[model samples]
Target: MRLLVAFTCLLAGCLAQKPQPCASPALLTGTFTVVTQNEKLEIYCKYEYDALGQRMRLQQQGTYQTKPFIQDFLLLFREGAMYQIFDTNRTCIKSALKDKFHPMEIPKDATLLGQAVLGSSSAPGQGLLVNTWTGDMSDKTGKYLSVVTEFGCIPVSTSYQTNDYGWEVIHFFNNVVGILDPSQLNPPDFCKDTVMKTDEEPLNFLSLFHNLP
Candidate 1:
């Protein structure tokens, strides 16, 4: 059923948080474009942090048209592990969550859905949407916004709908912080013979790891 409620909310967002505190360098770099729809999809993300906001490299890249078209993907969560590099599914998935933190779990009946001022102009902040979850968008629920800075919240956006299907991002931006070249932090090399996908099976693909929550 909807992939078993999206794998039980990705195992309850990796067993709910525990490893936070590390993510400001202006919340690690920027670049945005969310535009979601059946396929007007935009998503041209970017990130590369390290002094603890952790995320050592993440490059989403997109610009869709329809019928499953995609051309960019890269992620690397380092240390406590996580890596996903789907050059259109050539494959490279891995996972590890030790002392877990920041994977997912904003839905305690999420609701707000309003606020303002996002990023870019000298890093604007104070955005909000508090939460939302219109339910069953294939279990992704939907809508979550968070920007309030002083180096805190930061999430940005999300959306989903079901019936035929839908997705949304609308817009997002972090601005540009730093740290990203240990040769772009591994993963290429034709995805290094693809193996990595862990969770010790029994059902843990998590669709090639979508950066925790």
Candidate 2:
């Protein structure tokens, strides 16, 4: 009877210590591209994020107005600040961004679209599930479908577009990883300071007005 009790206790302890399946909170450092043929725009983005996703550095290199250009976007979530450095104008834009670290999980109210087997076969269980969701009552235009991978990452997402004719964006991430230097997240001193309201930011409104021209 004592041996049996000991065995049961051992089993219980082992079960409690078993590791649970948790997705990586951050993406691997790599480059992704955003190509819009109708707009004649191709943006090459290289991104890096801290393990906790509290800080990120994004570099966009591409061509605009038939000339090559590059820009850097920095997010310091801990400080509630965002900075943008533009190579074309040698300017830096700083603004407050009210963002906080939230654990990644599919929304409880999201509508399940379908299951998808994304990523290479070599990376086992890199599959994702698709879901459609609408934003809070204040924002009706935020309706979209998002693909959530087993790693808790959204590799693809789309805003509302009827019959697929309006507009769409797709991203493909290169499988790469490396240690990021802290200096990469800082904007250069030469960048003249510029500040603007979040809603009035040009990048924030690019999608809304780009089709006009």
Candidate 3:
């Protein structure tokens, strides 16, 4: 049969050699559970990177509910990390960064997910941030973007600027969502004076909350 179909296409091209990533320095922590229509979220992250990879610490913890509204947060990411934080409750909307829910400025179309390993997402609200994509909504406190694998794993797509809707960074989890791109995330410049985050902008853990009180 044509030499058994050319030896089954030469044994599937020598078993397709294309699965090689993860060398050393591994710490793309886990623990996630997300379900979105509006809310029902839980995330636990602990990322560590250095040796010239950037993204030293992106320790995030989130809790969300939408029965009567239960929101708990603690976010701190340095050097522009795509945001979309809300909870106006009509108090002049706190720090005010709204438009369609604002905080956009993390795209130079420089994929490799440099800062924290989040990239191209969807399945969060069924369509994922594409209302016309005007800015950023990559998730730091939104409730979607379960974990998009930027450093590596080849599952890219979280660049939806937003205009009307439909970019995608919703939510999904069962397992194996472990990616640590941005060239393996290496953050250690004493993490910019131990977790910056201050007066107006610039923040990143503050030396793990000043050694926790």
Best candidate, lDDT-wise? 2
How does candidate 2 score on lDDT?
A: 0.53
Q: Global lDDT of each model?
A: 0.46, 0.53, 0.31
Better of 1 and 2 by TM-score: 2
lDDT of 2 by residue, 1-213 (tens): 999999999999975552222333454566666555354555777877665646767787776545676667777667666777776777777766665643333445555554445554566566444333333212344454545443344444434332323433546466344435656655567643455447653332133223222
Could you tell me the TM-score of candidate 1? 0.25
Question: For residue 108, what is the lDDT in candidate 1?
Answer: 38
- How large is the C-alpha RMSD of every model relative to the true structure? 19.7, 7.3, 16.8
Question: Model 3 shows how many backbone clashes?
Answer: 39
* Residue-level lDDT tens digits of model 3 in 1-213: 999999999999865533222222233333232232333433343443332222343344554442223222223233343222232531111121111212212233222222231334454533322111122344532222222332333222223222222232323233232354543243223222333323454333222211121
Alpha-carbon runs more than 4 Å astray in model 2: 1-24, 51-53, 64-68, 86-93, 96-105, 118-138, 151-165, 175-179, 186-213
Candidate 2 or 1, higher lDDT? 2
Best-matching candidate per TM-score: 2
Ordered from best to worst lDDT, the candidate numbers read 2, 1, 3
Model 1 lDDT tens row, 52-126:
544445566554453233334344444455556676656666655343324323443444343334434354353
